[model samples]
Target: MFDSFVFMAPPLPDDLVTRYFRHCLEDSLFTLRRQVRMARMSGRFGANDETRLSLMPMILQSLLEDGIRDRLPLQRVDPEWSPETLVIAMHLYSVEARRIQSPEETRRIQQTFPDIKTPDFTSAEHTGQLREAYIAARLAALRDGTTPTSLSIGIEL
Candidate 1:
């Protein structure tokens, strides 16, 4: 259910961002329980640990800004909200980028993902897996021919 794309994010570093992604993937309880386990084991839970990080930005943005909540499951999938995840959310918004408030926003996305290839992304599927589905569908939607059915309301203008 994680990193199901051809260009899946490369191995992350030893930082909290990477560790938290690992931790959140283990459990469906929003955050991983093992982090606290390892924290207690290692001592101090290590503020330096990314597992103690926050995804509040994605959560709020997904809810307030994007209005695409079938989006990601913070509790079920993972909640590291790493730059990669943030980018995913941005691209997901790209799926319907045309519908948001500004042309500037749409142009920004073009700038953000200039290399967003088509055929590679257009076929992304859900595989009946939530996380996998989220990633695939979002990527697919970013393809050149992809204009979410909702596009009529925005860029088609």
Candidate 2:
């Protein structure tokens, strides 16, 4: 039933969409940076850590912000992409950078860096699910003429 439910809601205004996406992107970047830092401090940082850390800000400022402002679909910005794809990409990159080999390692990392959250879903199927949930929540908020306090982008496994 949940999978079949669909709301025929109008698109949010460009300005509002841009602002919302910008906020989400900023928060994601901040969290990623914090995770990178924590990993470095814990001596679990990956070999390519410096490159990923350096490139993230550039991606945010150049690619993400521009795409958000233009109201471009993720595919238009980059093929086979979505907002959730970006989130998943960042999470996976962080995981790789931290050299997390298994669930056990992830748990240990979380234990050490309580603030860092490894997403439960990184598979393509989960990415689509997350994207759907995010859009649904955003559309509901727009329909009600209120900004959502938080977007539902990461459903727990």
| Top-TM-score candidate index | 2
Q: Total clashing residue pairs per candidate?
A: 1, 0
Q: lDDT of each structure?
A: 0.36, 0.40
Worst 10 residues of 1 by lDDT: 123-132
Question: What residue pairs clash in candidate 1, if any at all?
Answer: 16-50
lDDT of 1 by residue, 39-157 (tens): 65678754334321333333434534344444444442355556665655545444543343345643332233323333323322311122222223233222212122334224543
Can you list the residue pairs that collide in candidate 2? none
lDDT of candidate 2? 0.40
lDDT of 1 at 24: 28
Predicted structure 1: lDDT: 0.36
Cα displacement (angstroms), candidate 1, residue 127, comes to: 4.8
Q: Give the range of the ten consecutive residues with the poorest summed lDDT in model 2.
A: 141-150
lDDT of 2 by residue, 1-157 (tens): 6433432333333454344444434544455445655786699886456444443443333332232232223432344445655554455444443332345644442333222233532343332333333333323323332211233323453
